[model samples]
Target chain A: MPKPSPKRKMVRFRDRAKCRFCRENVTHIDYKDTQTLQKLVTTRGKMLSRKRSGNCAGHQREAARALKRARFLSLMPYIS
Target chain B: MPKLNLSRVYEAMFLVDSGDAASWDDLVKHIANILTRNGAEIVGITRWDERKLAYTVAKRKRGTYVLAFFDLKNGLAVVEIERDCSLSEKVLRTLLLKADHFSVADMRLQLGEDIRQDVAQRLMTERGETAAVVHAVVSKPTHTGGEPVLPEPSGDYEPRHERGRRSERY
Candidate 1:
């Protein structure tokens, strides 16, 4: 078997939580809060997925639905 | 009533008086119940209590925000939800939206992006460009195709030193 590269081993460390958004409580992920929801949604009115946002499963789900609701009500733009 | 497509997602935002949070909770539950009874999927519910509004709404300066996200069959649910919101004295405002174009897969892709900066930067860039274009147009008269003429330098024109001193006296 080929030797495992040190860079490959270090990739796991880089994946650890370094996102400032998640660290700071600035963006409150609330399903009912359109102002906050607008931050998570895309200009095309699509909700950003968990892999991209680094939000835990529970919060990601909440944010996604909130974005959808905000878009539906025209509080958030549905399409760019 | 026309049959609604079962796979559509819907989201709603509602504001109620801060004093009426308890009352609004029951109303929100009722909406969830109705959606459930009608075979809608209850995705999530969030209650944001005791927040100040950017501007006074319904003559109140503060209110509680409730957000609900669900998937339901399209039909009279939208109308029914609106009617309920209108009848509830506790509810100051309500907004309902549909997420027909989004899917579970799409949502998965957006989970960890820094959306706030992205949005703010985009808005700022757009505004900045517009301002720059407007400034350029205003500074150069529309009829002039050539470069703008520089005004002649004159001693009567106050230098920066005098301009600062003059404003200080006012």
Candidate 2:
């Protein structure tokens, strides 16, 4: 992992965004739920990291796995 | 060796090609048979949605999704299931994974709404909408009421040419 530069430190703000799954009280994040997954990814079909998405470390990991599964099945684009 | 006793819940989401078939009942049954034949007890199968993909897959741009939940013993021949799905002509792609959170109640909560949405979508298309409105009209197309009437174009509707006319000048 690369060290955060001084500029990156200045950009840090308290994460106000709530984890979407926690907000929705949803425990199971299915790869087939592209509607929800789309929100977690950019138009280029890249998964947003935990910082930008405001996802907890645990849920973020799960979301990444689910998104990968969705990508593997061609349910989602590798490069939208 | 204790892995032999590990029974796990799995969810499989299949993208099916309906371009040639008039009905999906037989296809769904065939998928269920695949699960049962592989020793996975069926939990529920839900019609997730039908829509065009972001990019072409297998030379097809459109597909219908079937989300199936089942139980499988760990180390079960999941590869065989994968092989069968790949071999089947009706399936475009299949995603299988362990779903520890699925429950019997979800059968109604998920599939029940999915079935209702399917009917509503059919009705909408019958009234001259398109059959592929997976994200159109109602997000959760439940049995709300009588046939939905397409809303009239809002007053804010403006011609595209009009917007560019005043802005095109150098």
Best by DockQ: 2
Off by more than 4 A, model 1 = A1-80, B1-5, B22-27, B34-39, B101-170
| C-alpha lDDT (0 to 100) for residue B139 of candidate 1 | 13
Per-residue lDDT over A3-32 for candidate 2, one digit per residue giving the tens place of the 0 to 100 score = 988776545534555676677766656665
The i-RMS of candidate 1 is 22.7
Judge the docking of candidate 1 as incorrect, acceptable, medium or high: incorrect
Candidate 2 chain A vs. true chain A: TM-score? 0.76
- The A-chain TM-scores of all the candidates are 0.54, 0.76
State the lDDT of candidate 2 residue by residue for B38-85, as single tens digits.
887666676666666656888887777677766677445788899998
Please tell me which predicted candidate would have the highest lDDT against the true structure: 2
Judged by DockQ cut-offs, the docking class of candidate 2 is incorrect
DockQ scores of the candidates: 0.02, 0.12
